[model samples]
Structure formats: C-alpha cells, structure tokens
Target: MPYEEENIQQFSATSSSTSHSFLRSRIGLVIEARETAAAITSIADAEAAGVEQIWMTQSPPTLDTLTLFAAAATRTTHIRMGTSIVPTYPRHPLILAQQALTVSDIAPGRLRLGVGPSHRPTIEGVYGLQHTAPLAHLSEYVAVLRAALWEGRVNYHGNYFNVHATLPRTSRVPILISALREGAFRLAGEISDGAISWLCPVPYLLDKALPALRAGAEASKRSAPPLVAHVLVALSEDENAAQDAARKRIQYYTALPFYARMFADAGLPVAPDGTGLDALARSLVVYGNEATVVQQLTELLAQGLDELLVLLVPVQDASRELAQLARLIGGMQ
Candidate 1:
C-alpha cells in the first residue's frame, strides 16, 4: 500500500476520541534525575499532586528513560507517562519499537513515545555517530516505527533503515516527534501523533511551529495533533534569584547549535560567551509569585498552546514551589 493509504488504515484502527481527549485534559510535568529512585519519587509526587501526565527526557549521563518509566509504572497507577524524547541516532527503530511496546505492556493505556533526531553535539560529538541528513533519517525512522507499532508488521526499506519483522499487536502508543524548526514541525504533523517542543518561546511557536504543523497535517489529510511545549517555570518571590537560575538553564541551550539558531531566529540575544541571556530567559521561563506565574501561563495558553509540559527550574524551596504549582493547576480546572 502507498504511504497515505497505509497511514489512514493504521490510524483508523487505533485512533479514538479518547486519545485526543487525554491531550486536552492534562497539565504535564517533565521530571529528570540522575538516579532511578529519585526519578520514581518525583513521579510519585507528581501523581499525588494531581498532575495528569509526567514526561522524562533521555538526557545522556542520566538514568535511561525507559528504565525510569518502567520503574515509575510499577510505582504509580493512574498518572500517564511519556518520553519527552528518545534520540534516533543511538537507537534503531526496531529496537525502540520493541522497548516502547514492552513499556506499554507494563503501563498499558498510559504510554506516549516521543522520538527525534537529536542535535549534532550529542549525536556526533558525544555518541561519535555521523549526523548527516537528519531529516531523511527521521522520516524513514518514523515510517518503520509506525509500521511496527501501529500496524504490527514492517517490511520497510529506506535509506537509513531496512527491516522485515512482525511484532505482537499491542495497545497503540501515541508517537510524538521532538520538533524544533519548520522542517521538523512539518515532519511531526505529517507522520507522527504530536510535536514536542523545547526551549522555544511562545511567539516562535505561534509564528513557526504551529503553521508548519498545520501544513503537514493538511498534507496528510489529518487533523492537527497536539503540540506540547516543555516550558521552564520558576515559582519564587525573589525575582532576581529566579531570573538568575532561569538564565543559567537557558545558557545551557545557547551553547547548543540547533538551539542557538532557534534563539537567534526568535530575535533573542546570544552573547559570544553566552552572556546577556535575560531576553530568552524571560520569554521561555515563567518566574513569579503564584498569581503572577499562573497568569503568565494562562496568557501562554491563550496564545495557542495545546499543552504545557512544565520543567521546574531549580530554586530555593523547590518542593514547596512544586506543591504550590500543583494546587494552582488543580484549581485551573
């Protein structure tokens, strides 16, 4: 079957109103830790706080994402679990599909898989893998993954992947692509269930990400899927201290090539030595007292954000701050 026909058939079998409903209902939290126990604790805290979904990133030098989610699945029952992303360079589609399905078996109706071609520094410098034609690689990778996960079989032959296998028919796990730029946003809309964004300002999302995503969805003859923004939020009475901490977090991404370009495109300053980070920091990180923070987030949602995946920036009394945020979000409903 052709690609379009295959996609329609696959989605028809698995797509339901419930999948889209889940996206609209939740205020998600992204939790990261160097240790499995700490991560599971965060998951438990999030669950207890009435957080609807929890996301984990596959940041290198940290606990593996799947392991953390699997451990988290055993520890919590109701809250949903997801990967903000697992890079495609290091893991093949077949292996990723298998691992994701295993997690689905453990967690059942509560797994969302986010996958992407990560930036060059991690893929090339850290992993020592060639970062060539990433768009092509991701396109082919999604094809193979969808074939296996959605359709339960794959006889795919593409430039980057060649696989022939059949996997057990498991529950459909929504696949979201980590999209930053235009091409990536289109790719996510074209093939994947949703798009996961990081370190992008709200204006950029409205101007760039959303438009490209809509175009891709139109091309695919599918409704536009959920667009998840992984926003950095700091709740603090000490404005200066919160801005300082938020700037430090933004600085880390400025050093990265892909994010650096994104920052520049958004007209946020990037100093030679990565100083003068206030503009980007203020735009991306929501820092204020409880009321101010809630208002800022509300304004962002008004600007066409489908979901906000909150990443809490470290600050004084972080635990108390998280609890306060939980209460605020719980009241928002």
Candidate 2:
C-alpha cells in the first residue's frame, strides 16, 4: 500500500486530547543512573520533591526504560513517567507495546512512551545495525505502536516494518516522538501525541521546528501537539563550575554529525576540531544562581514551550543540585 494510504490515525485513538500540560506549563527532570536501584530511588525522590514528571533515557548499556518505569510505578504515586526516547531499531513495535502495556497497567494515565530512531552512530556503531531511512522507519514504527496500544491490533506493512499482531489489551499511553529537526518535528505533529526535542536551542524551535509542526498539523487537519523542549540546565551559585559542566556535556554532542549540523543551523556553528563549545553552551544551557536560573527558566517557559524536560548538569554535587533545583521548580509550579 502507498505510504499515504497506510498513514494510520494519530496515536491518540481513544483520547480526545493529549497535551502534556493542559492548563499551565510544567517542568520535569531527567533521572539517569547506572544502577536500577539508584534510578528507582531517584524517581521516588523526584516524586517526594514534588516534581511533576520524570523521564528516563535508554541506551544499549542503560537499564531498560519500560522495566524501570514499571518499578517506579510500584514505588511512587502521582508522578508521571516518560521515556526520553526508546530506540525503535532495537525492538519491534509489537514487543515495545507489550512492555509499555505492563507499565501503563501499573500506572494508568501516567506513562508517556517517547520513541525515535536514534543517531546513526549509536544505532549502527553500537548495535552494528544498518541505520537506514530513519524517518521512514520512525513513521511506520509510531503507526504500528499506536495501532497496538490504542486500538489493540495492528496490520501495518511498510518498507521498514511488517507487523500484523493483536495486543492483549489496549492502553492510553500517550505516544511521543523524538524530534531534532523540522522533518521529525512535522512527523511528530502528524502521527504522535507530542514531540520531544533534544538540544534544540530556543530560537531554532521557534523559527524552524514550531512552524514545521504547525504545517504538519494543518496538513493532517488536527491540532498541533505539544513541544517538550529538552533543556540542559545547571543550578549553581558558582558560574564557572556550571559553565564547565555544561561544556563537558555539550561537547559530547558536538562530535555527533546530526547534532553538529543542528548547532550550525541554530547559528552556533563549531569548528572542525570542536572549538565553539563555549558559544554553544551560552546559547543552550541555562545556568546561574537560584534567582538568575529561575528567571531564565521562566523566560523559557514563556516562549510557548509546553514543558521543559530539564537534564540537570551538576556542578559540584548531584543530589544537592537536584534537591535545590527541585525546590526551585516546585516554587515555579
């Protein structure tokens, strides 16, 4: 079948709406730990600190996100759980739906499954799998996942996926897609419940991503979904320490081709040997004392962002930084 004809309905089958923050904007934290016990403790801590949501990142070496979420579901109540992104190439859509269903059953109306075709390096270099036609693969992957989780069945046959399966049960798990560029953002608007962006500067989101998302929604004849900005923030009284931490984390992405191009497009280009990291950090990271950081974050939320998925970069102490940041964010709410 043609791709257009095969374009399934947006993943919100039974949902009338799927906005991340319906009334007011919200803030969330990214909880990452090498140990499962530590990560679960972090989730409980975020909940106790009154953090609205907690997102987990999945990599080959990291703990499986769905399993972590299931554990968190049993431990914490009233805090939302989301996957920053679960790579699609590693798991088939049906299998992912099965795992997500368990998490959703444990914590109903609180699981947001964000998925994507991760970068070429991680997908190919780490997994030794051919990283080919990522957006095409991602489009079909969301369709299949939505069919299973929302409608309880899938009969999708695309270039990258051939799935005909019936799920044990349906769920209202809001499906979100990782979007770095305009194309992916548009795809998210058309097919998924929301778009989760990483390392995209605020201006780029306003100038490029939001326009593409609106265009996609206009074409699809549906309301545009929320754009959850993945912001790397550091809460520190010592400016130098915060900038140093931001540089270390921001430099890692400079080596990646996709992120490098995005940086250039966002008007903060780096040298071939990665020399413009300071400029990138200035444009990307929100750091300073409590008052200064809160002001910057407030301005960010004012820029029409539905939610800030804060990846806090610690300057000196991780736990202390998180607790202080959580208190500030709680005050914001």
Candidate 3:
C-alpha cells in the first residue's frame, strides 16, 4: 500500500477539535546571544516589549538551553521560556526530565520542554552517536519524558531506552517535539503536547503536515495538539536586500538531504547549483516594513498555527529591528 493511503486507513477516526490552554496563541521570539548577561538582558528586553515567550536552541558549542532559561528565570518574572529543541540522543530522558523539573521549579508554569532526535550528520558525525530509526527513537523518548514529567514516574523498557525512575513531583512542563515530515508530525500528535516546525513552508504545513497531525490525534482518540510555526522575519523596507541576507542562511539548509526532500515535497525543488534558491528564500522568509510583516503574520496565523516563533533576520541594526518587532506585536495585540 502507498504511504498516505496506509496512513489514512490506519488513522481514520475523527479527532476532537480541542483548544489548548497552554498555547496562548501569542507571538514569541527565538533569542540568541553569546554572553550570559547579554542573553538575560535580551530576555528582559523582550518581556518589556510584551513578547510572551522566548525560545532558545540547544546544540554543541552553544549554551545549554535549559540552563540558560533557568538563569533567566531568576532575572525575569513572567516571560515564558522554551527550548526550540534539545537533542534526545545525547541526554538521557530521565536526565532531561530532572533538568526540566528544576527549571519549572524556578519559574512555575513557564517552561515548555521541546525535544527531538536531530539529523544524522549532527548526531552521528558531531556527537558520534547512532541516528537510526529516529521517529521510533523520538516516540520512545517522548513517552519516557511525558511519563516522567507528567506522571512523576516511569517504569518500562523500550527499544531505544530502558528506565525505572521516579520524580519528586509531577511537573507540568509541556513537552513539544520538533517535526519535519508527516511521520514526525503524526508521532508528535500522538504523544507530544505540540509539534514545532522549522523551515517548513506555510502551504506544506497547512496542507500536508497538519492533516497528518490530526490523523495521529484521531488514531489516538484525542484532541489534536498545537502546531508552533517557526518562521523567518525581517523588519526592513528593502525586500531584495533582506531576501539576499535571508538566502545566505536558507541556502545552508537546502544542501541538507532532509530539508531538500521537504522543499521538494512542497513543490519547490532545490537545484544542484542553487538556481532556485532565491524563490525558496522568498517562499520561506517574510520581509519588508512593519505593515507588510504584520499582514504576512496575520495571514499566517489565520491559517491555523497555534503559536508564532519568529527568528528575526539581521538586515538592519539588531536592537532597532527588535524594537520594531516589539512595536508590531504590541500593536497587533
């Protein structure tokens, strides 16, 4: 049987259209800084600007995302913190659960723990760990995390993990999973609190990714989880210059096989000599001045995204761009 047909047969039930309390349907930013004080300062700045949440990435040679949030928790009062993704292969599920619990303790009801089995090159090549059966690994990983964080104990054995551990208390940290294709999206719907998408075109997300998520939720006899769209935003009037800057960053992903497949599946095939890159950048990035960005964002949210995670493209001054973004978000609210 074909993949889509098999999936349809397997997950034919209807999922309840449920709303999520944890997902406040607000705008957030992906914050990055090299220095601790600078990152914390950025967090405070964002909070002052009325941004609801701040997401940070975790990979080698970067500050541990959770620990940074833990530090930021002491400095800020209400701004929510999230890990865009913490790789599953490196850290054991129980360990991550414990770390997440600490963060939750510091800032109650303010942590969203996002985890995923990252790509093969980064996992195997960089971390020197095997990256086989990633979706299966992620499935088991999320199960363990949900059990440990939500239920306060985990006592089971799975193909990729074996654990029997208990936590001091049940933490309410919503575990979101990173998704690329339908398989990962379905797995996220079945197990995770939400699915976090990066670089997936808006059309593919609405047309293909979301249906798969709903199907998984339907099969599991549950309400479909939220979809957090990670998008690129540039606050600049010069569309061509901003796109040129965006292309430099996007071109790196096009070379990756997984991203290449996703782009192709979305009807934007990548050429070997990078002939079609400008179009891909234009499709993926939202540039221009404040009014244009606001319209683009409003249109995107109207398409059913539960949250917006914007990574601002550095076209002009960073601080100036952040101020403009803050103003735009404030006005929209």
Candidate 4:
C-alpha cells in the first residue's frame, strides 16, 4: 500500500479513548534566542502564560544554549527547560554530563537534557569532524552519558568513547533524544527518557514513530516514554501571511538532507531545491487565526502526541507575535 493509505488506516484504527486522552497532555514552547536578555524574557513570559515547558535549540552562531538555560533557570521558578537537542559530535559525553549536572544544580528538577547525533553536513562539513556511524556513535554516547548522569560514574569503553570518570553530582535530569527515523526512534525508546521530533506530520508520526518507539521500549522491557512533537506555529488573521511566514521560517530546514527525507517520507511534495511551500506548511505548520490554530493543535494532540512544543514563527513585530501567541495559548485553556 502507498504511505498515504497506510497513514489513513493507522489513524482510523486509533481508539477514540486514546484520541481524547491526549487532549490533556502537556503543551510547551520552543523559543529562539537572538540574545540572552530576549531569551530570558521569553522564557518568563511563556511560563507566565501557563506553558508547561520551554525548549531551546542548540545551533552554531547562536547564544550558547546551556548558558542561556542557566540564566533562564534563575529568572523562572516553575516552567521546565530543555535543550531541544545538543548535538553529540563536538561535545564529549563526559563534558555533556557535567554541563547537564551544572544546569540541574541551578534549576534542580526542572532540567531535561535532550541530545542527538546531528546531521552529517553540520557535523562533518562544518565542524571538520568525522560523522561515520552516527547511530553507533549515539548509542555509545547515550550509554556513557546516561551512566554518568544516573550512577555518577561511567567506566564504559565503547566504539566511539572510552571514558572512566565520576561526575560531580548525580542528576535525575530526564534525557530525550532527537529521533526522526526508525533507528533513532528505537534508541530513544530503549534508553533515553523520551523522544523529540520536528517537522513530522501527524499521520506519519502515528504510523511510523509511535510504533517504532513502542517496539524499542517493549524490546527492552521498559515502558514507552513521552513523544514530544516540535511544531512550527504562525498566528495571524490573514491565512496567506501566516503560511508565508511559516514557509520562510522552515525553508532552510527543507534544504537539509535529514529534514528533506522526512518530508518526502511523509508524502509531502518537496523538491530538491525546495518548492511546494503550501503543502509543506499545511502538513507541518500550525497556522491561521486564533480559533483555527487552536482547533488544529487540539486535533494534533488527539493523534497521540504526548507533548506539543510550539515554535512560534514570527509573522510581524516580534513583540506583537509573542503577545499573539500568549493570547492563543490563553484561549486553549
């Protein structure tokens, strides 16, 4: 059967009770920091607006994610903070464990450490590092990182890492892995606390990710962890303007091989050079007026997402965009 047909059948097979149960799942926001001050303010504002969690991305040429989270920890009291993912390439597992523990010390139970083997282009092309055997690298890195965080010491020698060190403090910081395809998904379910995803359509997530996650968890005889969806959101009265903003926001990711493959697998028509903005936005973006966007989000949650991490796509003025997002979140309650 074609992927689209399989997606529909899977979606239809989901029980009604499960669909309704997801409505009560946690909702969060993903904020991009232009600077430290703005990021801190955004975290506070989102928390005040009753967002359950706040996630930040780790990328080069941006404000350091850990440093920003440390600052955010001091400014906010209740909201959970996480790295949507820190790539495991440049940073050693020991160093990553230390940094995560330091953040946990500052914020205590409010920190969740999310890590991933980032794309080959960024790891190899830009950083001048070898990106061979990413799955193997992630498995070893996560094993060492998990041991260090949980047991306070790691004495493992794996294919990618050979470390024997005791961490300063043991942390209960839940580790989430960025799992897009089957291998990453299983790895997350088997070991990590949860799985994090971006740019994945709802149908594909139901048909592919959820099953893979369950299989891995079952294989390990552990309960399946939360599946967090990171979605791009644009709020505006004008539908065209909202979609246009979403298109511009995500166009960069569409060019990356990882995301491009994901979009294609979801049966979205994406060209090699990045066309089909409308279809892409419809499948991946949560856009439109307040009520429309809320309905769309509720529908997405009903598809078995454990958490929805909303990444606001700035449509007009930044301040205005945030205010609009706050209002939309307010309406959801």
Better of 2 and 4 by lDDT: 2
Cα lDDT of model 2 by residue, 1-333, tens digit: 111221222321222432423212267789889998999998888888777788899999899989988988899987889998999998889999999999899999888899999999998999999889899989999889988988899998889888888888889688889998889889987887788999889999888988887788778887777788888889876767877898888887888888888888898888878688888887788888878877777677666666789898998888888888766665654
Candidate 4 local Cα displacement, residue 174, angstroms: 0.5
RMSD for each model, in Å, please? 4.5, 4.9, 5.7, 5.8
**Candidate 4 segments whose C-alpha is farther than 4 A from its true place:** 1-25, 330-332
**Candidate 1: tens digits of C-alpha lDDT, residues 52-142:** 7888888678778887788788989978888888999999998999988888888887888899889898988899999989888988988
Deviation (Å) of 57 in candidate 1: 0.6
How far is 65's C-alpha from truth in model 3 (Å)? 0.8
User: Against the hidden true structure, what lDDT does model 3 obtain?
Assistant: 0.81
Which lDDT tens digits does candidate 3 get at residues 67-161? 88988999899988999899999999999999999999999989988999888889999999999998999989988888898889999699989
Candidate 3: how large is its RMSD?
5.7
Q: Model 1, 17: alpha-carbon shift in Å?
A: 17
Ranking under lDDT, best-scoring first?
Answer: 3, 2, 1, 4
Candidate 1 has its poorest 10 consecutive residues by lDDT at 11-20
Off by over 4 Å in 1: 1-24
Q: In candidate 1, how many Å is residue 108 off?
A: 1.6
Alpha-carbon local distance difference test for all models = 0.79, 0.81, 0.81, 0.78
Query: Which residue pairs clash within candidate 1?
Result: none
| Clash pairs (backbone) in predicted model 2 | none
